[model samples]
Target: MKTLKIGNTTVDTVLEWSGNLFDVGAFWPGRSWDAVEAERDWMEPHFIAPKDKSKPGVLAASIHTYVIRTPRHTILVDTCNGNHKTRKTIPPFNNLNTDYMEKMAALGVKPEEVDYVMCTHLHLDHVGWNTKLENGRWVPTFPKARYIFAKTEYDHWFANMNGHAMDGSFEDSVLPVVEAGRADLVENDFAIDDSIWLEPAPGHTPGSVCINLVSGGGSALFTGDCFHHPIQIANPDWSTQFCSDLAGSATARRKIIDKICDTDTYILAAHFMDPTAGRIVRNKDRWKLKI
Candidate 1:
């Protein structure tokens, strides 16, 4: 649980769950087991999965949300998977039973106090908390908050409602927010305030974006799925199999790495394990995450 202040705004994390779920070799397709094994000492316990029958060797991840408290508003970045969501494609994420709200409350943030909910992309894990089940009906969890969604990202998934990418999330979590008239579809570079804004970093998904926070003199970048594991920070061209456009994802990742590496900007990864936020640095001719 780390917190940082950017000028007048403070950013904190409320974790839902953290553990390994995917095999390391398979999670990053084309990656060699040797490369993964070499990083064992650094990845173990937090990022690496213990050997098991289901997935013998995999990389675990943290599922959580960032609470951004500005002087005038409270904003949340990327709601983690919610309880009772039907995600059959990934059984572990399906019908989850985590005390997400309790954790949110522990942060002194009631759902009603949230002014905006921003999702870097509408993936199952990222948008599941947008709505919750109540009395047999799905409704916006943060009733007072306007859910900010990139128009390009929403349109693509809404049009292909049944696409695997949607994976029933559009119908269950996202559509309900829109139907409830709480969705604020905006452009990729939309700004929420003088110190907060969205930056286009499409590739992993059509509308994928990053939330930027700059207050006082501090700066941080809440990168969505643009870089899942810190390993990707060392190898910007290593696009995950889940990326819709491999080349585009690599290009975008490289560009971001170049922009933030060796700077004060903190890279707030969406699925990174504990101590998820850190800065990138130059490692010889490559890069590394210094958490």
Candidate 2:
């Protein structure tokens, strides 16, 4: 709801909601449902406790838009959920009706003024609003921007675009944009401009990446889905039960945490609770978010 400047970049946290309802002892691996009560307690102080654990974690359909004011051009990282898309299996993300464009306009960011749009991944929630409905067709949301995608991530998702049929995210959240000629697929550590770069961060999804912004005598990292909660700041090993590759993901999370803990970088977690962006510090031998 507010914009904060990090040197040459402006990070706007456009979020829907932030809570730890989903994994509060109620969530588990595919069939590994035995609640780890102690770990849950370890996670308590780091998360917002919801009375009801029967429901999924309530999250806002929001996007963290980054406006990089560099000498070259302007880039917007990640568009939030758009209106009227086919509902997802999750309740919180279902039938979203928020006005994302209006919020962008309020911040004086027009689609045309945006020269590039970068997506950390192509998940239904992450890339749902990357395109817009125009005259009965889904077109690139940013008319003048070259939509960037990780080459590996794009290929895998594109290959299975409609193969899954039922849960094919590419069909709804991606293909439309590719048809619109706005997608710009690049490498894992893809560098767009001088101050901004995308680091290869796999595990959450095959081609997951995080955005790094350098400016204002400071730095910030837009951790796509690497560390969803600040609790991960304490227990980086306690990955979500649904993570694709737990070991790989944990390694990546540690790497980023180390970099931020040592540098002047702040984190912009897409799903972190209040004090969304901050530094990482060592608590004993473990890491924690220094809010």
Highest TM-score model number: 1
**lDDT per prediction?**
0.85, 0.67
Candidate 2 stretches with Cα past 4 Å from truth are 16-21, 26-64, 67-72, 162-168
Please provide TM-scores, in order, for all candidate models, with all chains considered together. Answer: 0.94, 0.84
lDDT of 1 by residue, 1-291 (tens): 577777888888988877766565777787876665655555554555443522455677888899999999999999888889888887778889898898889889999999999999988889889999999989999999999999999998988776654678889899999999999999999998888899999999888998889988889999999998877777788778778888888888898898898899988989888877788888777677876
Q: Which pairs of residues have clashing backbones in candidate 1?
A: 7-215, 7-216, 20-60, 23-58, 24-58
Instruction: Tell me how far candidate 1 lies from the true structure as C-alpha RMSD in angstroms.
Output: 2.2
Q: Write the per-residue lDDT of candidate 2 for residues 100-163, one digit (tens) a residue.
A: 6776777677778888888877766677677777787777777888888999988877776643
Top candidate by lDDT:
1
Which residues of candidate 1, in runs, are more than 4 Å off?
40-56
